[model samples]
Target: MAPSPPPPAASDAQYAQQFLNTVLSQRGPSALPYAEDVKWLIRNHLVALIDAFPSLRPRVALFNHKDGRAAHLLQADGTIPITHAGAVYNLPAVLWLPEPYPRAPPLVFLSPTPDMLIKPHHPLVDCSGLVAGAPYLRSWVFPSSNLLDLARSLSHLFGLDPPLFTRSNPPNPLPAAPSSSMLPAPSPRAPSEVVYSPRPYRFPASPQLAARPPPTEDPAEVFRRNAIAKLVDTAYAEAAALRATREAEANALFAVQAELRGRGEWVDIGVRKIAEEMEALECRLQDVTMATDVIKAWVTENHKGAADADDAEAEGAIQPADVLSRQMLDCTAADLALEDAIYALDKAVQEGSVPFDGYLRSMRALAREQFFQRVLCTKVNSAQQQAHVTRMAARAPSHYAS
Candidate 1:
C-alpha cells in the first residue's frame, strides 16, 4: 500500500520521517555500511538533497560489484536542473553513495532515458555516464563536504556542458547506468570518470538507457537553483580558507607562549641569584661596621691630634701597652714583622745575595721569635675578652639600680 500523505502542519516532520524510513527499511550490512549514528548523518545529507531539490529521493537498491560481490547501496534518482545556454534542461541522474561514505566521495552517473544517447567525446561525462573530475568531488574534504554541495557542483558543471543528446530515430536505448557506480578502489584515487571506451563497451541488446523526458521546469526555480549552487560553492571555498588562516594564527600564539614561559623561568633564576648575593653583602657590611666602630672608640679614647696643643693628652707619642687588648695587638704586629723578615731572607738566599748557612741561621732565629709572639697573642686575646665581659657584667647592676 502507498503511504498516506502527511498533514499540512506535520508535513515537514513526517516528510523527513518517511525518507528516513525508506533509507533504514533495508536490514543488515547489505543495506548501508555505516553504524546507526553514521547512517543517521547519511540520511540527513540525503534529506538535505531532497529538501533542496524535491525531485531527488534516496532509496535502497541491490548493487552488483564489478569484482563479483554484490551489496545493497543507497541511490538517489532525480532530475538535476541545468541551465544550458539560457535554456533549462532536466538531466536524469543516479547518485550512488559509496559504502565508505563521508570518508569517500560519492559517485554520480548520467542516466539518460531510452530516447537519448550519450554524446561521444564529452569532456565531463564519458560513454558510461560516470561523472568525474568535477572540482568539488576531486578535492572533497570529509564531514564538511556533503551530497547537497556535490549536487550543486554537478548541476553547475552540467549547465555548462550537456552530457547527453536525443536520438532522431528511436532504434535502441543506450545501456542503463551501471547496476552501481561505487566501484572498488584500491587507492585514494577517485573513481575514474572515463572507465569504458565506446568501442570496447558492448551495448546490451536489451534497452538499458538513462534518459528523462523533457521537464516542465519552472523559470524561477531554475534560476533559484543555479544561484544557490554558486553561493554554496563560494561559501565553502571561503570557509576553508578561513579555517586555514585561524589554524596558523593559533600555532603562532602557542609558540610565543612557550618562548615567554622559558624567558620567565630564566628571569626567576636571575632574581634568586641576585637575592643570595645581596644577603652575603649585607653580612659583610655588618662585619665592616663593627670593625669601624672599634677603630672609632680607640681613636676617641687615646688619639691626641698634633695640632691640638691644649688637649688633655697633649703628646701624640705612641702610648705604652696598658691593657690586654693593646698587648695582643703589639704581639700580633711582631708576629707579622717576623714573617716578613723570613720571607725577605728566603728571597735573598734564592738571589745568591746571602750565604745558605747565614740565611738558615737568620730564618731559625725569626721563626723562634714569631712562635713566641703568636702564643702571647692567643693568651692576651682570650684574657682581654674575658675581662671586658666581666666589666660589662659589673656595670650592668649599677645602671639597673639607678
Candidate 2:
C-alpha cells in the first residue's frame, strides 16, 4: 500500500488567520475580513488592524463570498461587497514566508478561475486589462498586503451586484426568441365554478411504481448529423482554396520583382561602359591640344630663322624646301585640330551618346576645310620662297664673279 498520505496540512481557517494577521500588521485598522472568518477564525489580524489604522473602523467590514466573489462580508447583513474591476472575487490569499522571511514575494491567485480568456479572440468586458489564462492566478507581496485590500481594488473596475443585476434592478421581462415551434405547447386548464367541491387527494393503496424506459435516438437525427459534417467539410475546403490563391498572388509579385532587378542591372552596366568611353575620348583630345601647341612653337622658330637668313643674304632668301618646312610646321596646328575633330566624331558615333547628326556633319566639315586651307597656305608660301631664292642666286654670282 502507498505510504499513508502525510497528515493534512493546516486547515483553511489557519490560512485565513495567517492572511488576516499579515494584513493587520501592515494596514492595522484599515484591514477587513469576511464575516465567516471574523466569527469562526477570530485571529489577532483584525484586532491588530483596528488598533493600528483607526480610520478603517467605519469603512471596513467582514463580508460573505458565497453569492459572488468577495473577500469580505459586512457583519451587519453578511452581504459580500462586490469589487469594482475584474469581477472575480474568490481570490485565495495566504501568508507568505521566504526561506528567510521578508525576502521573496508571496504567490496569490483566485481559487477556481478558468483560462478561457487565453483564447485568441477573447472578448473584453470593461476597461481593466485583466485576462483569463492558464492556471489563472495573480501574485502579491505579503509583507505589504492581504486579500481584502486586493478585493477592494479589483471591485472598482468590473464589480457586479450580488444578483448581478445593475444597482439591484433586475430585468423584468426576460428576453425570449420568437417561437419557431421549438418548444412544447403548454397544456390548457379546464374552467371550474363549483363552490363546495371536495379537493380529492388520491393515495396509492400499495404505492407500486413502474420503471420507465430510457429514451431512444431517432434515425432522422443521424442523417442530420451527417449533413452537418458535410457542410463543415465544404467550409474547410473553401478556406484552403482561398489560402492557395493568396500564396499564388504572393509568388507572382516576387517574380515581377526579380525581373525588374535583372533589367536594372543591365541598365547599370551599359551606363558604366558609356562613361568609360567618354573619359577616354576626353584624354585623347588633351593629347591633340598639346601636340598643336608644340607645332606652333616649332613654326615660330622656323619663321624667325628664315627671316634672319634673308636679311644677311640681302636679295637672297632661304630655299623653297626650307620655306615649305616652316609653313608645314605653322599649319600643323590646323592639322592637329582637324585630327581632334575626326576623333571626336568617331567617339561620338561609337558611343551613340551625341544624338545630333547635324552637329556631327558640321564638325567634320569644319575640320576638313581648316586642314585643307592650312595645306594650301603652306604650298603658296613654298612657291613664293622658290622665286625669291632663284632671283637671289642669280644676283649673288657677280660678287664672286663665278
Candidate 3:
C-alpha cells in the first residue's frame, strides 16, 4: 500500500499570525504606537513571499536593528543569480521598514561581504548604497503595492542587461592642474586617506552618447536631449510592463484550461466536438476529390476529342480547340489544389493537432472554395450548351433551305 498523504499546510493568514507571535516574543513589542498593525503587515507580506518562493524560507531572517527597529534580511535563495553588467554578484540584502508601514515603501540595501564589489549604475540604486526607485519604492501606493511586489520588481531588474558603465572600467583621470605658486603648500594627508585611493567618480555614459552631437554649452539643446531620454525610458518601461501583464494572463489561461481538462465531462465534450469536426472535414475532402477527378476525366476526354478534330480541321481552327483544352486543364488543376488543401486539413484534425475552432475555420474556407468552383463549372457548362444549340439551329436552317 502507498503511504498516506500529508495533511494540508496552515493557511497564509494563520502562518502569518504564528510568525508574528514568535517575532514579538523573541524581540519584544515594537515601540511604535501602531505596533500590532505594522507587525501584522510585515508578517503577512513575508509569509506571502515565502509561499510564492518556498526556497527563500530558509534564508530569510527578521531582526531588530541597532536603532531598536525591526528589519528583514533575505539572502539570495541561489535560484536567482544577481548579475550586473557582465559579472555575477552575490549580495544578501536588507529591507528597512518605514515607521508608518504600508504608507511608505521600505528601503533596500545590498549587504555586501568584505570582498564583494558593487558599482552603482542602476537608476534606482544610489551612491549612498540605497536601492530606492519608482514602481517599487518611490512610486509605491498603499494597498496595491507590497513587499512581495518590490522583491519581484527587483528580481526582474537584476535579470536585465546591466548598465554599460558597470561593465566598463572607469575612464582615465585627467592630470591635476599646475599648483598655484601664490598659494601655500597643503599639509600631508593621513595614512588612512592616502592608502585608500578611490576611483574618480564620473556620470554614466549613455548608450546613445555617440549618436548624440558633442556636448554643447547651450542649455536648450541639453534640456531637449534630457527630455528625449526620459521619454525613451518611459516608453521602454511601459512596454516591459505590458509584456509582463500579457505573459501572466497567458499563464493563467493555460492553468484554467488544464483544470477544465481534468473533468470527465469537459474532456468528453471536447473530444466529441473534435471528432465531429474531423468527420465533417473528411466528408468535404471526399466531395472535393470526387469533383476534381470528374473534372480531370472530362478534361482528358475533351483533349482527345479536340486533338482528333484539330487533325481534320484547318490550322486556324486548331488554335481555338487548343485554347479550350488549356482552360479545361486549368480548371482541373484548381479543383485538384482545393482537394489537396481539404485533405491536409482532414489529416490535421484526425491527428488532434488542430484546435476545434481552427478546424471549423478550415472547413468554412474549403466550403467556400468548393462553392466557387461549382459556380465556375456550371457557367462553363451553360456556355457550352448554348453554343451547341446555336450551331444546331444554324445547321437546321441550312438543311431546311436545301
Candidate 4:
C-alpha cells in the first residue's frame, strides 16, 4: 500500500489570515524577518508567480545570508517545466527571496533527491546547489524584476544545461530523503505524478557517516553513460512524433487524390455519352430532308384554287391556322435554331468544356444546314406572293373590260 497524502491547506480566507498573522509577527527577535512594506511586495510577487506557474507553492525556510546571518525567509519551491533537446522535463528547484528582494536578486538552488545526482561543472549551479551568473540575476533591475521572470529565466538556462541527472545505478538500501514542510505530503489515493504544491517542502541529504561503503564505478562514468542514454531516448521520441505527423499528411493527400480520380472518371463518361448521342443524331439526316420536302409540297398545293385543291388532305392532324404562315415560319425557325446551336458550341469551346476540334466540326455541319433551309424558305415565299398578286390583277381588269 502507498503512503497516505497530507491534509489540505486552509481556505483562501483562512490562508490570507495565516499569511497576515505570520508577516505581522514582529514582536520579538525571532519574529518574522521581513519589514511590513517588504512583506506586501513579497506577497504580491509570490501571488503573481503562482498565477503563472501553479506548480510552485510558497513557504518559509531558514535562509543562510552571505554575512553568516540565518533568517526565516519566504521560499517558492516546486518543479518548473524545461524543454531540452525537443523534450520537456520537470526540474525540481527552489526559489529563495531575501528580505531585501526586488532591491536584490532572489537566490536559486537545485533540490536534488537521493536517487538523483548533481551535475558537475555546470556553468550556472555549484556543488552546494547554489545558482549564480544567470542573465536575469546578474542584470536584475530593482522595482521591476519579479519572481515570475526570475523563474522563467532560470528555467531557460537550466534547459540548456540541466543541473541534475538521475543515477544509472542507485545504491541499494538507500536512506529516505529527510522530510521537510517544503514538499506536500503524498495522499494514498494520489497518483505518482509531480504535483506543484501551492506550498511544498525541503529535503535532507544523506547524513554524514564515517564508515560508508564505496561505489562500484566512478561517479563521472556513471553520469556520462546516463546522459548518453537519455539523449538517445529523447532523439527517438522526437523522430517518432515527426513520423506520425508526416503519415497523417500523406493520408490526407491520398484521400483528395481518390476524390479527384472519381470526378475525372465521371467527366470522361459524360463526354463519351454526349458524343454517342451526336453520332445517332447525324444518322437521322436523310429522314429530316424527306420531311422538309413533304412540307414544301403541302404548302404549294394549299395555294391552288378551290377546283384544283386536294380533297384528300390528311385527316385528324394539326394544320396551320391564320395565326401565322406555318411553312415559311417553321423553315426560318429551324434555320435560326441551327445558328443558335452553333453559337452554343462556340461558347462551349471558349469555356473549354468541349474540345476545339469537335466544336469546329459540329459548328460547320450546323451552319451548312441553316444556309440550305434559309434558301429553300425564300424560294417558296416568293412564289406564293407572286401567285397572289397575279390573281388580284387579272380580276381587277374583268369588270372594266366587259
Candidate 5:
C-alpha cells in the first residue's frame, strides 16, 4: 500500500496579511493592540486544541483567512472548516485588549452545530448578559499561563476526581434545553453593537426560595431543641466521667508518692556524694586563691621596681626604695581588691547559693572594675601634674626676669 502523504501545515499567512492591512486601515496612523497578539491568538488556540484532544497533536497549524484573522488547526491537513458553531464562524476574530486575552478563553458560538464539539465545563462562566453578540467572547487572563495549559485544565475538569487519588465514576447530568419562558425577550442590536442578547439560560433560583424544609414539623426548631436536651445529658455524663478520672489520677499520684518515699535512702546517698564533691572543690579553690594572692603581691613588688627604673631613666635621679614603694601603692590596692573578690566568690560557690560559673564571672567583673579604676585614677593624676608643671614653667621665666 502507498504511504499517505504528510499532513499539510496549517496556513494563516493570507489571513495575517489581511489582518495587518485592516489594522492599518482602522488606525490610519496609531498602533492598535500589538501585532504579536494576532500571532499569539492563532498559536494559543492551536496549542489549546492539541492539549484538549491529544489525538490532534499531529494536526496543529494555522489556516489563512480572506479577512485578517486566522484559524488554528486540529486536522492533519492543517485546515479548519469554513463553517462552525451556529453561524458562519468564518468571521475574522478581532483581538480584545482587555484582561482575558487568548486565555480569557475562546467563545464557541460562531461555528455551526457541528462545531459544538463538546460542551466545556464553565470554569469561569460569566452569566451576566454583558457580551451578547455573535463574536463577543469572554476575556481570559492568566498572567503566568498560556492557552494550551488552560485547555488542558478545562479538559481535566470534566473528567478528574476531587484529589481522591482515584478515578471518579460519578454520573454526569445532561444539560436540559431551556424553555422559551426561561429566556429573556430578544432585544434589538444597537448601532456599533457586536455582542448578542440576554443570556439563553434563566438565572438560578435564590437560595432562600429553593431551599425546602423537611416534611417533619419545623425540623430546624425541633432539631435545635432536641440537640439542646442531648447536649445537657452529654454534659452530665461527661462530668461524671471526669470525676471518675480525677479519682483514678489521685490514686495514681498516691502510689507514685509511696514509691518515691521507698527510694529516699538511695537519694540520700546521692545527695551526700554531691555535698562531698562540693566541699572538696571549695578546699581546692581556697588553696588556689591563696596562691593567686601571693603571686599578686610579687607582681606589686615588680611594678614598684619598674617604677623606680622609669624615674631613674627619666629624671637621671634614683629615688629611694620607700618612694618607689609608695608609687606602687595603686597596684597593691588593686591586687588586694581582686584577692578579696576571689575569696568571696570561692565562699559563695562552696555555700552553693549560686552556681560556680556565676560566682567566677562575678569575681572577674569586680577585679576588672577595680583594676580599671586604679589605672584611671593614675592617668588623671599624671595629667594634673603635667598641667601644673606647664603653669610653673610659664611663671618661672617671668619671676626669674623680675
Candidate 6:
C-alpha cells in the first residue's frame, strides 16, 4: 500500500493567525458597545500572549453558549503532559475570557481524559479538573495581568506537583533498565507514550463547574472568615451600645419631667398661701386707715373746742394744743405703718415672689385708704382754720373796743 501523506499543518496555523487578526481589528473604530480604551487593553494582552507562547498560538472565539456574548481562548497545543503512577498523560487546558477582557481574570479549566483521574491536592486544580481559586486569580487587576503570565504560572505548577494519576492505581517507583549488548533484547515501551486513549479536544459548553468551594482548612481562608465574623460581631455590639444610650437618655428625660411637675405643684401651693396672707394684710391696712381718719376728725373737733373755750375764757374747758398735736402724730404713725405694708406688698409682686393678682388686690386696698386719709386730713385742716379765724376776729374786735 502507498504511504499516506502527512496531515495538512497549515490549517491550525491559518486558524490561529486569523483569530489573532480578528482580535487586533476589534480595537479599530467599530460600533461595539465596549470603550476604546478597554478594547485597546484587550488587544495589548492578546499581543503579549502571542509573543510569550508562540507554540500554543492562542486564538479568540465568541462563546455563544451563555446568555451574553463573551470571548474564549482556544489553543491546540495548550496541554500539560505529566508522568504519574508510572504512566504519562496529557491534561488538556482551556482559558476563558470574561466579557470585559483585561478587567477580569480569565477562567482556566483542565479537561482530563476519561481514563485519567485527578486528586484534590493541587492548589489551583479542582476536583472537576478546573484550575481556579488561586490568590493571583482572585485579586486580578486590569492591565496588570495577561494570558501569558497565567499560562506560564499554570505550566510551572505542574512541575512542582502534578495531580494526574491512573484510576484505582497507586504510584510505584520504576526500576532501572539494564543495557545488554551480547543477546537479542526485547523491545520496551517508550517512556513518553501516553497510557490513555486520545479524544477530540473541545472547550466546556458551560463555564459552570462542580468544583468544591474554597477549602476552610487553609489557614489563610480560616483567618479571613474569622476576621469577617469578628467585624460583624463588633458592629452588633456598637449598635447595642447606641440603643442602650438612647434608652438612658429617654429615662433621664422622664425623670426631669417628673421633677418639674413636682416643683410646679409646690409653687402653686406657695402662691396660694402668699395670696391668703396678702388678703389678710390688705384688710388690716384698711382698718388702720379707717382708725387714722377717725382719730384725725376727733383731734380737729377737740382743737376747735379748745380754741372756743380759750376765746370765751372758760378755764376748765380749755385744753392745750399739745394734746391735739400728740393725737395728730399718732395718726401720722398709723398712716406710715399702712404705707410700709403697701411697699412690702409691691416689692413682693415686682420680684415675682408672690402672685401678681393677689398683690394687686392688696395695692388697690392701700390706694383707697390713702385717698380717704388725704380727704379726712383736708377737712380737718379746714375746720381748724375756720375756728382760728373766728377766735382771732373776736380778739381783734375786743382789742379795738378797748
| TM-score for each candidate, following the candidate numbering | 0.46, 0.21, 0.32, 0.40, 0.19, 0.33
Regarding lDDT, does 1 or 6 come out ahead? 1
On the 0 to 100 scale, the lDDT of residue 115 in model 6 is 41
Model 1 / residue 323 / CA error / Å:
42
TM-score of 3: 0.32
Cα deviation at 252, candidate 4, in Å, is: 66
lDDT of 6 by residue, 1-402 (tens): 111222345555444444444544443332233445675566556556655654343533333333433323322235644442233435566565555566777766664544455766765577755566544465455566677777665554453356554444433534433322211111242332211112333422221112323223567755765575455446645655666587689999999999999999999999999999999999999999999999999999899888887878865554548544545555566677888988898789889988988888888888888777666666666666777887887878566757
By summed lDDT, the worst window of 10 consecutive residues in model 1 runs over 192-201
Q: Assess the local accuracy of residue 211 in candidate 4 as a C-alpha lDDT between 0 and 100.
A: 28
The 0-to-1 C-alpha lDDT of every candidate, in the order given, reads 0.68, 0.40, 0.53, 0.66, 0.41, 0.55
**What is the C-alpha local distance difference test score of candidate 2?**
0.40
Which portions of model 4 miss their true places by more than 4 Å? 1-30, 66-68, 173-402
The TM-score between candidate 5 and the true structure equals: 0.19
lDDT of 5 by residue, 140-183 (tens): 33343353453343223222211111112323543433312212
State in Å the error of residue 13, model 2. Answer: 48
* Local distance difference test, candidate 6: 0.55
Estimate, for each residue in 1-402, the C-alpha lDDT of model 2 and write its tens digit.
Answer: 011112335543443344444433333333333232233223343334333322122111222223433232111001123442222332211121112222222222221112111112322121111222211112333244433443343333223211122112323544332222111111121121111112221211211111223246466865764465455445545654665587689889999999999999999999999999999999999999999999999999899989888788984544435655667655776677777877787788678767678666777687778868676877866786787888788788676756
Residue pairs whose backbone atoms clash in candidate 4 = 5-186, 5-187, 5-188, 57-198, 182-200, 182-201, 182-202, 183-200, 183-201
The alpha-carbon deviation from the true structure for residue 158 of candidate 4, after best TM-score superposition, in angstroms, is: 1.6
Backbone collisions counted per model: 7, 18, 0, 9, 18, 0
List of clashing residue pairs for candidate 6: none
